[model samples]
Target: MIVRPSLTRSIPFWILLVASLAVTVAGAAIVATTLPAMIAGLDDQTATGGLVYGGQSWITIGSGLLAAGLVGLFVLLALAAARSFLPVVKPTADAIEADDAETGDDTVLVRTDEVVPARDEVPAAR
Candidate 1:
């Protein structure tokens, strides 16, 4: 028995995985089945046949590495972008002392203490 997940989350990833696997499998099957014919047609060119298999193998290997590299690149890019938007925070005493800023210097305190405690209170015996 298979459990189904909601469309909002699991479906998209499953769909992509299934589709990619199907395409890769079907493509490899086609390439495998066609390789001999292709080689024979091209006068038994071993180099070409090897190149075809090698290319597919490289594509398989490169896919994971490419995905990882791109993910890492994007993470770095996102971090850099976020850093640009953030205010520089000073830490050391020297840096803190070097800071000079001016504002109205007025502070407002908001008092919020009108009582509404709980709904489950019972009167105590006096």
Candidate 2:
């Protein structure tokens, strides 16, 4: 019997792909809709724009790094999933011959020396 491995058949691969895509889209949306408003609000509240700009720069860098890390994790998961679907090679002729020699008999032998007592022969508990 021969079995083939498939990535599409694996549940983990699809799960990871979906989760990564969701995180990427949601993160991007949140940043896009909120970053500008937050920066503007901070600038208005603060006496100097420099502090707000610096904070925004750090936030942008941190978000970029987080996105990159998520992407890297997704790629790693994909690679691991792909590794499971690698092709299987057939056994060599020598290996087949050795296996056949090791188990040449098709019939199995059994021994029946022990016997069990009938239900009527057992004593009831007090």
Candidate 3:
């Protein structure tokens, strides 16, 4: 797909933040300019005030969306980086062989799903 410049991945959070601020300021300016005229003509001060409030509300919504998008972008970037840096992470057989040879750990067989003995079966703690 198109991996365009994103906030967290490429464009950076600070740029997105600046964009949010600019959009918010522009929206606020539009509301501020319209409110006085709305008050004079419509004679509804509350509605006039609500114009700015609505602008702010929508700005907050846009910021939240931007943040979410950026977070996802960053996660993808991180996953890609990790995949590249740590490809095919298989355990080396030589290490296991060395451990078995040196420590006689072959027969120990530390099973991951081994059941633990109950308190009665276990030796009492001094």
User: Would you list the C-alpha lDDT of every candidate in the order shown?
Assistant: 0.46, 0.58, 0.50
Which residue pairs come into collision in candidate 3?
A: none
In candidate 2, residue 102 scores what lDDT? 68
The order by descending TM-score is 2, 3, 1
lDDT of 2 by residue, 1-126 (tens): 222234666687777767776666666665675577666777688535655565577567657755965885679577876665554434444545555566764222222233333223567799
Off by over 4 Å in 1: 1-50, 91-126
Model 3 per-residue lDDT tens digits across residues 29-122: 5556554555554555455546566645655665565566566556656755654443222234564566577778664322232232322355
18: Cα error in model 2, Å = 0.3
Q: Model 1 compared with the native: what TM-score?
A: 0.32
| Native-referenced Cα lDDT, model 2 | 0.58
Task: Name the candidate, 1 or 2, with the larger lDDT value.
Answer: 2
Q: Which window of 10 residues has the lowest lDDT sum in candidate 3?
A: 110-119
Compose the digit string of candidate 1's lDDT tens values, residues 1-126. 111222324465455555555555655555555555556656755457466676556555555544544555465456546544533332343322333222322221212223332243588999
RMSD, one per candidate, in order: 17.8, 15.6, 15.1
Candidate 2, residue 68: the lDDT equals 64
